[model samples]
Target chain A: MKTLYIILAVFFLILSAIFSYLPLGTIALIPISFAFLFSYLVFKKSETPNNKFSKILLILTIVCLIFVLVKVFFIKNELEIDTKFEQQKIENNKDAKKDLEDLENDLE
Target chain B: MKKTLLILVLFFLVTSFKSDTENPVKSGESLVYSGSYNMSGLLTQIAQVNMTTEKVTTAKNNYLHFSCSLATYSKWDSFFKIRDVYESYVNPISLKPSLYKRNINEGGFIKKEKYVIKGSKVNSTVSFKNNQETQNSFTIGTNTVDVITFLYQMRTVNFANFKVGQTKSFTIVFDEKEMDISLKYMGKETINAGNLGKKECYKVSIAAKTAALKGKDKNIIWLTADEHKIPALIQFSIPVGVGNLTLKSATGI
Candidate 1:
């Protein structure tokens, strides 16, 4: 059981790191952090103290969560800017057609 | 077990929120335009006009062409003028290549004009010809003249590849006139166009830095969001009055 707990904690820590760049990283990291904490509790009966392993897992999970939060906020502005540019293009095309038609009629 | 169920619910909620905001319309799809209005000229001569526009992709060159027409009383004088204007532009595309082939029965106007812009250092010449004997010519510096057909050609090519959220910016040069313009999509909205019923349309607005014609105002075009981005309804407000053009009926695709 103790060995299994260690493996589960390691797996979750790696997953949290990988998804840290996505919007859902913080939420995903929550379960992984809980797993690492629960695993520590489960593996406390071991003869040797796992202080180094627990510290590394906690640090890695925290770093992953922060990375994901930053990414989500950074991309928000970029999405708005892209939509604005597209809107401008549609407006310009409509104006050009109207202008052309009006010019044709005026000359006639 | 309760915690696991809560997590699952939260995951679904987050994903559903994201999916709801995605645009439903695909890029480069054609939409229809329809609307109706009354047109009147100098003499209190009123005519009820209905107009419809359809965007068609030509199989020959993949160019996007707008096929549109307005129907009103046959007695209307403006109808002849409008027909003349339409023939001037539309006939050229078909007749330009076959200038040598003239049928005795095909009695139509053919006009051609050329203008040269000789500035301090820049020089360019533009030709405008129709099937009519009367031709108009204008020459100016390279900064003010606009080539009317070039704008139409740009629209043809750009709109062919245009995506829903893409903005196309280009400057059209005629002889000495230049019109710098931008087209922006304002998304889809349902408008209550009287008599034509409620329509789901892509509202597009246009702004031009320079307009050559006096009565031409900044344009707002509404295209039905179905299978044609042709202008279903168009509204332009000048200093004199407001002009609304709507698609009443259409025959050709």
Candidate 2:
């Protein structure tokens, strides 16, 4: 189990480092931090499970995750807004208004 | 406890020998649905879908050819025109698709895909309007069916055998990946089916999320409550409102 934990930790660590250079790179921090917590808990039976190197890696991962969360919540992108749906709503309202007018004219 | 376990095992063994049901897709028949896409209850666009099956002779053998086409009413063509056609050549007995083709023209972005299945393998080819072509191959089970074929298969199924609240799931390997479908039977209801008027229908909810359009919403389908099991209405949630395709007329009885 200890070896398996080490393998998973190393795999996720490499994957996180690689993906951190791509688009939405900050998302990679999630897996890295999750892997750190999981590996530490599972391998805590070992004498040096909380070694300085592992502790520092876990801290860095958490810091990166915090930074990403803050940036995503605070930053806004105008282009990401769904303007197409808004346009459709406006068009549908116009059609409804026309239909109502035709109904009123028929009643008159 | 041991005696009861033995009896349970014996019961399962006996039930495991049940016979398979026959395929229910009839040749030379078709289904048509016509409805409008309303934005927040305001009618904005209209859509019509037609699916038909016929006997055709392919190069290698004779097969039942199924064709389904979806077209937006010409009035709404200026807004968002969609002309999609799906064709599948299926085994007359097994009802498995031997060859399938899809031609889609949505919002002027055109794409074409073809699948040729032989025994346990399928070869897929896709081409875009921009002249990019990709070819791939995949292994599939003998009972594999494409999306269009799956719809017709659903129509032919004996829903009465399944209890209400029962969910049927199928995984289809297409477009290079497996897509999971979960269809739940939601009891009987009477719905106004456009020109068809009010009819007894079996309500089924397809829990496929409409994430691309807007908030997560399930696609609801109402099948005519008879052996034919025709679809009365299909409602989809979009970014703004619900889009429905209701059955208006019928043919090929």
DockQ of each: 0.00, 0.01
Error of 2 at B149 (Å): 0.5
Best by TM-score: 2
lDDT tens digits by residue: candidate 1, B173-213: 43235566555566677875444467787666655665432
Give a tens-digit lDDT track for model 2, residues B193-234: 655578889888775432433433257889887766778888
Q: Residue A4 lDDT in model 2? A: 68
The best candidate by lDDT is 2
lDDT to native, each model: 0.41, 0.66
lDDT of 1 by residue, A34-89 (tens): 65575565447456676666666667766765666665455331111234324533
Interface RMSD of 1: 25.0
Give every candidate's TM-score on chain A. Answer: 0.53, 0.49
Docking class of 1: incorrect
Which residue pairs clash in candidate 2?
A: none
